[model samples]
Target chain A: MRFINVIKVALRALRRSAMRSILTALGIIIGVAAVIAMVSIGNGAKSQVEASIASLGQNIISVYPGSATTGGMHGGWGSASSLTVDEALTIRREISGIVAVSPEMRDRQQVLANGLNWNSSVNGEDVTYLDIRLWTIAEGEMFTEGDVNSAAKVCVIGQTVVAKLFPDGDPVGRSLRIRNLPFKIVGVLKAKGFNYFGSDQDDVVIIPYTSHLKRIARRPNLNSIIIQAESPDQMTRIQQDVTDFLQQRRNGRDPDFTVRNQQELAEAATATTKTMTVLLGAIAGVSLIVGGIGIMNIMLVSVTERTREIGIRLAVGAHGRDVLTQFLVEAIILSVMGGTLGILLGVGSSQLISRLNGWPVLVSTSAIVGAVAFSAAIGVFFGFYPARKAAQLDPIEALRYE
Target chain B: MSHVVQLEDIHKTYESGEVPVLAVRGVTLTITGGEFVAIMGASGSGKSTLMNLLGCLDRPTRGRYLLGGTDVSNLDRNELADLRNQKLGFIFQGFNLLSRTTALENVELPMLYGRRHFSTREIRERARQSLDIVGLSNRADHFPSQLSGGQQQRVAIARALINEPQILLADEPTGNLDSKTSVEIMGVFQKLNAQGITIVMVTHELDIAHYCKRNLIMRDGRLVSDTPVVDRLVATEQMQRIVTAETDAKLIA
Candidate 1:
């Protein structure tokens, strides 16, 4: 007759068979736990990918040499030639949306500081490279445009080289030898960690492009160019401007180079990770459905076992709605209890995994709420038939049941 | 006298695998308020089926059955349940007290099912008073299994009385008890009947039937005899000896 009374009756019935109640709860527990854990793992991976894409700077654009479409050298190298330093300067002057531009020359060499030498690459660029790649000088001054023009021997080193070569001293204003040529360390770059490909961004060295082309690479051309736009909203216009400018600079030869914007790469990464999360969550949901079916089966058995009890209540005064309400409440209580316990278990296990294995794990609020609601809905959906059967039982036959 | 229950040409037929088995054939009966009656018949003679019809648990295949002057033959399931709660109390042979509940709570169950509103204290107090009427107030906290067969039947009787129903229908109430316990239970029934509560009991025991003022015997789904018990025994006077023994058992427990 009253809602609380229905809960009391359902609880009393569940208490009658302790072992069966616990066994039924076990299925829901595993189901909810799997959902929470798997969802957290998926969210964790997605968040990590987002962080990685963010680290690359959403306003930055990378231009790589595009392959030749027609008769590449008539079978020459089949690849586009390196962009020149003069082309990079022309882009900074002509492009309407360009915020910064840095032409780069890269070569492998052993860096010498004090008595320790590390085999790492030398990246030659102007002061604009730091802004284009979203980097900052942590120590002294970065090599200026004057250094690039005069071919000065000043350089800016990454945090990794500073750690290895100058373990106990300040690396700024110190002399380091690259390719057996002496150079002054003008500044230390800030740490930017690793990328998706596990490449350490802090392990390279930066120098003036003039110095790199004249002394290190001994080449007259540039390798690539990094560009930063005013904002992410301006990326498309900036890409068009760069493509048009490069084609014109190459004498309308359809300059063999490709422009990649950060927004597109981030979107691709997001799509990949979101798909992975759903795939994992769906697999875990199968176990939840099985758990719901298990609850339904046990509820059916309970109705059968307590047939006489149902009869007695019906004989006394209970309506079919009353009988059905009692059983449905019992099912919900069991699942809710299981859901709460499963959340605790899932969260604790995720934390444990992160701490023990150093794996990325983030528990989002949506995952918790989603799992709990799903479990409760499962109880109602699966428990309905058994409750209906109990409600519809014939009181006369039930009273006579042994 | 105002009749508490009436059956007019009632008929019941059971369909078992395409064959109709007649359970009751055109039985007409009336029970007045405060009358104590017994239906005596051999097994399968339709006495229990008639009891079910009176209790509103089942409907007759034909004819009208009236409880408290209201025709209930065509009532819906919920309305029939309401009629049972308000007008009838049932006691079964197996002492159908819910085994897990305490005697007090078991008595309060029927009252709880009805739409009437009562505070918890009021419900408990009413249940306690019903238990006292059955002389089981001291054992209110005891479970069904903790009591003897006769005591459990008394609890059932208490449950039946809790709703203050106009009629008590007991189907073979003492069928599981020994001779002494059966007579003691008969004493309780006589006392209740004397208090102006109408009762209809089904029993095969001739001696048990003698405790009631009126007796009807059925054979082959039809009433063969209706007569008055001219020399009904004073069951309470005979019950004193057994009550004394039961007192000793309660003390031991």
Candidate 2:
């Protein structure tokens, strides 16, 4: 028989049992939809983590002090301050890939402004701190190098500190008392909502490190050093160079500092999300196989039910291949149609979820196409056995079947 | 007349289970074009097996069977299907018209698988003409379920004739119809045979067999008798007589 006629006949046969065909295709629809939704969710989570990391700073590397051991009682990292201001300046001048470096000292202090006292962490660093941390001034200006040279008591307040200390007016150029000493607020920092650890990022105050060392928290050793690479691609090399330089400066006695970069954080976050996506995709793939089995079951029953019809077709001059093509086409049509509907459902549901829950979802075109092709392949794989069984039927026996 | 079908020492055995039963035991038969012949036997006498072999639906276990001067006893499944399509038409006892299909489409089915490529318009026109030949042109759009038994049988005949085969093979063609409807069906067969189409029919009813020009009797899987009908019954005349008798009885009541 001609190919067109075979398709027409297959369509007619499917139409004869439209309900069964739709039911058989439902399994595939759910499977494909689940896969698409889960994958999009995974992609969304990965991008969300990347965006958070980007907000923290670009190509940032932080150096923490080494651990301390007194009388065999070992202290964890950052227990003793081994880094100093001179070392931070040396890294800035000597490292070829280093763009900016700042010595950091931290302390919690109570500040009184407009008769409201608020307790917030006071971060002290040089003017390079703004560049290394990618923090911008929202109101006035950052504390300049001249302020650090003379140990001037000028500060930059973050959004949370301003909200608590000066609720109705701008805090720039306003006088605030910290540790019974009067300080002038030079700027208000821009808002950065939260970090990956759910801590408020804009809840601190920044001051000149020279002022911090002379008056606020008289310390000889620095807490940590923050460095920024010239570009994102140079981060790993810069980190290695910094590590080697620190080891040499410390006489290579098990290096007193540890270097960490944003790339490692991003990679760790991405790996977790990717693992979840693959796990969800694998679970959905099982449903697709189950859907294929459903198709096989329905096709087998169809072949048995239409045995006499097949016999009549054979008696009238239809080849076995013709019968095989007819059933195979039916199976393919069912699965392809289901796959198309599944894509629509998946996209719509993903959008709905993102909108309702305020989560990110990315629906890639390649994933949609791959899902459709996979379903079509599944149709062929599962449809083969039933079609072959129908084709191999003996016409005489089939015709004689009641 | 040219010989359209020739069988020599044909045998068929059925190995349904452990015991082997011979359905047709070494029977030789020859049928010529334009001849209307009927094979009559009781059930289990191998008349159906003979019809199957003649239709090329089943191959004979022994001997040669030639169709239209071509040896076809050993043809493969596909070749046999082609031969059946090109040279033979079959009418089953059950009026085996596809239930959900209209009369016209049912008649168009055979040509869909025919060797010659026919356009849709030509197929439709030829199917209409075949239905007209069986006096079913008015019911072309009706499904088999909507038609009476006799009408359904007529549609089956139209389907059988749509391919324009040289020979028509019928297995108990009127077995499901009333006596009057059976006579009407027989009249249609006779009309086709009179138009120079050879027909081989299987019927156990003697009255139905007498409508043909010749009769072959089978006993124990063998052709025990072959003779020309001494008093052939014309189906049209028999149908007219039945109608008149029913009318006369109704008037007497």
Candidate 3:
């Protein structure tokens, strides 16, 4: 028989049992839809995490002092005063890949400005702090290195502080009192949203470490140092250089500081999300296999039910190959049609979910194409046996079937 | 006259579980072109098996069977199918018209599998002509379920004739119909035979066998008798007599 005529006959046969065909296709529909939806949701979450990690800082490394131990009572990391402002400057000058470095000291302090009082974290850092943290001054210029050298009482306030203390007016060029000492606001930092730990990132004030030691906290050995590499590719090299330099400075006495890079943190976080994505994709894949089995089951039933029709076709001169092609084509048409509908449903539902839950979801084009192709493969894989059964039937016996 | 079918000592055996049953044992026959012949037998006398062999629906287990000069007894399944498509048409006891299909589409079915490529337009035109030959052109759009038994049989005949086969093989074509409808269906066969189409039909009814020009009787898996009908019954005349008798009985009642 001509290929088109065989296809026509298959379609006509399927149309004769439209409701049954649809019911048979439903399994594939749900399977493909689940695969698409699950994969999209997983990819969305992974990318969201990556974006958040990117926002933290690029190629950043933090060096914190080892824990303080007094009389065998040990405090946690960054409790000892091992790192100093001199070491921070020396590393910045000596390291090849180092772009900037800052010594950091943090304390919670009450601030008074414009007849309002707010309690916010006060951070003492050098001029390189902004560069290492990838923070920008949105309102006014940053305090210069000269200001740090002079122990100038100048500060950069974050957006959360601005919203709290300077709600009615701009804080730049204005003085705010921290711990009863007045400090002039040099810049207002741009708003940085919440971190992965759900803490407000824009709830702090930054002042020169020298100024902080002289005017606010009084005595402070450097708590930690933040370093920035020239590029992300140079992070590990710079980290190793810093570690060796710090070890030499400490006389290699069991390492008094810990050097941690932002890449490590990002990799750890992304690993978890990647595992989750694969898990979801695998679960969805199981459903697809189940759907393939369902197709096989229905196709077997269809072959049995159409025995007489197959006999009639054979009697009218249809070859066994023609009958086989007809049934196989029917199965393929069902799966492909189901796959198309599933893709539409998946995309539509993903969009609906994004709208309702405010979650990011990415419907990849490759995924859609892969799903359609896979379903077609499933049709072929599952449709073969039943079609062969129909083809091998004895026409005389089939015609005589009641 | 060239013979359309020549069976040389054909034998068919059935392997039923542990027992082998001989269905047709050494049946030899020859049917020429344009001859209307009927094979008659009891239920287990192997007449149906002979029809199956003649239709190329089954390969003879032993002996030579030639259809239109092609030795078909040893042909493979696909070749036999091609022979059936190109050389023979089949009409079943139950008018095997596809139920949901229109009569026109049912008639177009055989052409769909024809060896010659037929365009859709040509297929439709030829199907209409075949239906016209069966006097079913007006009922072309009706489905088999919607048609009467005789109309369905006529549609099946149209389907059979669409391929322009050399021979028509009908197995109990009127077994499901009333006697009046049987005569009406036989009239269609006679008309096709008069147009030079060879026909081989199977029936148990002796009266039905008398409608053909020749009768072959089978018994115990063998051909017991093969004879030309001395006084063949004309299907149209018999149909007219049946109608008249029915009308007179209705008038008397």
Highest TM-score among the candidates is held by which one? 3
Residue-level lDDT of model 3, residues A130-167, one tens digit each, is: 76666798999889999999999899999999999989
Q: For this target, which candidate reaches the highest DockQ against the unseen true structure?
A: 3
Where does candidate 3 stray beyond 4 Å? Answer: A58-60, A70-75, A93-100, A126-134, A144-152, A179-182, A218-220, A228-244, A252-255, A260-279, A365-370, A398-402, B248-253
Error of 2 at A173 (Å): 6.3
Q: Distance (Å) between predicted and true CA of A141, model 1?
A: 5.2
Model 2: C-alpha RMSD to truth?
A: 4.0
Error of 1 at B109 (Å): 0.4
**Which lDDT tens digits does candidate 1 get at residues A1-402?**
888778767887778667667867777787788888888888888888888787776578777776654543432222456577777888889887778888878778998979999988798887788776667889998888888889999998888998999999598988899989999999998899987679888998889988999999897777678888887788889899888877776786655777777788888899999999999889778877787778667766666556777888899989989888887887788878888888888888878766776668988687778777777776766566655765686678777765
State which candidate has the highest lDDT: 3
| Cα error of candidate 1 at position A126, Å | 4.1
Q: What is the per-residue lDDT of model 3 for residues B30-109, given as tens digits with 9 covering 90 to 100?
A: 99998999999999999999998899898788999988887888888888888888788899898877768889999998
Q: How accurate is candidate 1 locally (lDDT)?
A: 0.84
- In the order shown, the candidates' Cα RMSDs to the true structure are 4.4, 4.0, 3.1
- Once superposed on the true structure, which residue ranges of model 2 sit more than 4 Å away at CA? A49-61, A67-77, A89-102, A112-116, A125-156, A169-188, A208-211, A227-248, A252-275, A364-370, A381-384, B13-21, B145-148, B176-180, B240-253
What i-RMS does each candidate reach, in Å? 1.3, 1.7, 1.2
